[model samples]
Target: MSTPVDTPAPATTGAAPAALDVLHRVFGYDAFRGQQAAIIDQVVQGGDALVLMPTGGGKSLCYQVPALVRSGIGVVVSPLIALMQDQVDALAANGVRAEFLNSTQGPDERRRVEQAVLAGQVDMLYLAPERLKLESTRALLDRATVSLFAIDEAHCVAQWGHDFRPDYLELSVLHERWPTIPRIALTATATPQTHREISARLGLDDAAHFVADFDRPNIQYRIEPKAAALQQLLKFIRTEHAGDAGIVYCLSRNSVERTAAALADQGIAALPYHAGLDAGIRARNQSRFLREDGIVMVATIAFGMGIDKPDVRFVAHLDLPKSVEGYYQETGRAGRDGLPSTAWLAYGLNDVVQQRRMIDQSDGDAAHRRQLSAHLDAMLALCETIECRRVRLLAYFGQEFAPGGRESTACGNCDTCIAPPEAWDGTVPAQKLLSTIVRLEREHRQRYGAGHLVDILVGKRSPRVAELGHDALSTFGIGADLGEQEWRAVVRQLLAQGFVAVAGDGYGTLVLSPTSADVLGGRTSVRMRREPIRASRPARATRRAAAQPDMPTEAVPLFEALRVWRSTQAKERSVPAYVVFSDATLRGIAATRPDSIEQLAEVSGVGAAKLETYGELVLEVVAAAA
Candidate 1:
């Protein structure tokens, strides 16, 4: 489901001109953003395309325009019911004829939409990939004229993608059955390897592949040490993102409930969402998040795929995400309006230990285990790196991040660039940590996790240490120069650097890697990133400056008023406020304060349909504000 399903008007004879006309007539944008023009042209010309654009880089327009201008109705295969609902609603707001067939609808509603499909009354039709598995669905499509087939979130076809759906594997039948229908597959996040997998699985290897830059410069990335984590998260929301619509991601359902309750106790309008919750509760919470302002949803990874909320100001990670791809995909959900936003995470030594342990215990063959470990390793590299966060993030996706037209370098926006970390030599510290792990495995014939090892290194006479006879070890008290936290940092860095590994078939115990011998033999030195001494939260001015690319001070009143008015319209229409006009468009309206309908129509999001729908109302808001 998306914003631009067309009106099943007569097919235009020309591809480029028809697509360009649809862009201005249906959607509000004057011209295509990034590769939308080329992609749309390719699709309208009845050619297949594989588009890898960023989440908010006008990906919808590529298929939306062609689906409208082409000869017949477009069939879109989407994975999420909420996504389909939003897309159908947004397209309706744009005066486009879009209908979706999903389980969310009753039999009567489905019958009506199905009948419309048969009668050529629908412009674009949305369906879940699971729907295509039914012979009845295939027969319906066989009867209807399908101009194109757009596979949204096409990365799901990859067997190893973060969100893999078995039904996606069967999507290639779209080509097999309707061999001449132009197919377009779109995804927001995919590594080069995943991209290849998507192409091969979807049989789009022969299609035109469009890969836009994966960099999201508006998002400021920051990873903080997880200490007093609940308090830290509370302070972050209170100071950096107060009264903002954002998402908090936790790794477990229990964590989601606890975090959501904690935030609610603190008076934040936060709700919990996970598979364990009642289906109706989950749906209501998701709907509230989409429709209301400043509602924070604390959820597991299950909640976010294909969510189309545009004003999400921040996305916080209470625990380390499993991989770089997962991290990128989650963070991309924020700042979709091209406004400044934040991607914050609280990471610690236990994150590494827990992730490693999970990977070791995960059900898969050795190759799958290795694949999971590789993913965690990449995520750890991102969290532990002393270099610019954006550069490392982009490089992971096989792209070079060039901010402000500079070479691939520091973004001057992330936590690392804003307050660079010190890469101090820890060759001796590495030996001390590795020596402890070595002694535990060799001398005592036992292994332990970081807590026990750090206790030993810091010379703590804990009962476990005394019971295990670790106090008499030669390495005891030798590392007393550093505290327990410092020792844990050393262990974490070594683990991240691969000088040590977690023991196989053990309870998260530290074990030496093959490279540990190199460090112990004095052949390799270690460089550790010193966690900078910084304030737990940004200061008063930082809190005040939460809104990025701050608008003119004088326009504040008008903007807020317009927001209130937009909220009213959305509630009345029962659609997301963004489906009416994006924050960017509202900002444009506020800045221009256009009094006439013609002037208001010139704003970026005000297409011909919306111009006729809400132009007069917006003019009234502007006039009343004046």
Candidate 2:
């Protein structure tokens, strides 16, 4: 027989079995979700891991449980101080020993926290990545027995990630200082490239990787053509999802402010949130949203990185995000509580042109630019697709979707299922449009936006047409059979189908792409939707009444009273009425007849502030009505 060597003992001496018992007793949950248990077990067994989970998928428990169940202290490197405080407060509520060190903490409090860590009084320590860059912090880590290093929102380590942070690049230094410590990196969103970059940059090449399904089946995804987006958004909020907690993401700070103001004017309880606002204001707004219920936050990309709110019922994108990854992460914030939710977006040709211009203007290499363009094109295709939005979304994450896969494979709750559009063949018109673009180049050495080009094609004799003398050209008057609107629709379809390209520098001048030749030469056919004439004011009024039937007859009077109450209360507090109660919530209160404080809490959009301030007034209105 071969000489038997001494086998290594099981690595259980440092494992905190008593802490695992505490996890079960305090949280009242028996087990973890999906790969959470495996990841936790591995970390407890002294192994590093990288986890990719979707929003509301319990990515927090992967590290949270390990932090509680491991020996020594668990150091979590996070980015936002507000998010840190939220996490710490939530943990403290559950009887977990968690504290954070950042600018938000006073010098004396920081010393106390540091002392707690040294004395083994704290189970988990949360630090901003900026803290890791400090020499003093590095020295502190050298002395403390860190059981694990958890990098939350770990995608920040990659330049290609949507929310890249330069400070995260220095996280590799952790391996040098704590070579024996196990580490785990977790993020709500990351692509394969981002995953590779995170593993490489953080020196977690040998770490176990666990990627959950990217699909959020509870979220109904829908994209509408950009036509009066604010009105469409308001209607959406007022109808199916009235009185629900939601987030409306805008592309700019001004859009955030204006949209929030418009919602307020309409009697919606909403708040504007962006980096431009002071930190205290943003924090207060965020806290009000979290501690209370049914408050809609109109924000930019600056909000909701590590937000832990569970009942976010919907997320609407008023503008296109820079990439599909960004779009997915932001939209994923909805329906986190496993309830039905909606992901609504309004996109137009202008969004595509603006995104292209930003990419071309960026100071990146040619390869990077090409990659960015390809990513944007993919996102555009997803937006215009008629199939299941969830299928297309998951495919972008490298997941193969089966055809007709409806068993949790596709969310049947989207707009396509609700109201499918009619499509028509426009191959002949598409060919004519391409031919017009070519003839225009031969006639005049100039590029034009879509409007002027459509004018020339449809033979509209405007001043610009007379000045250019384009009525004399053969292609100008020949295409008058199609209406101006019809020709414009053809152009839009051509752009979406990739038969034409828009110039990046000059507000998107029309340019023919290689695919144009295929359409012009009759090698490929094109089909498009007939451009629907916009409804007039009377038609809109008729449609709105027919579309939404839940608005009770009592709603109008209740709404008026709520508005008066809100105005008086807002004047007292010196804030907007929207800062008091939204129109939708007031409508619900009016319709539901909530007469008591508990009943008022059940009203949609009646949060803590409104309940504290106008609760009595609302009850009086209900009593008077009764």
RMSD list, candidates in order: 4.4, 8.8
Q: Which is the leading candidate under lDDT?
A: 1
lDDT of 2 by residue, 96-177 (tens): 6888889888889989999888888888899999988999888887878788999999988888778999999989987887
Which regions of candidate 1 are displaced past 4 Å?
1-15, 535-550
Residue 128 deviation, candidate 1, in Å? 0.2
Model 1 residue 124 CA deviation (Å) reads 1.1
* Per-model TM-score on C-alpha atoms: 0.95, 0.79
lDDT values of the candidates?
Answer: 0.87, 0.76
- State how far residue 85 of model 1 sits from its true place (Å): 1.3
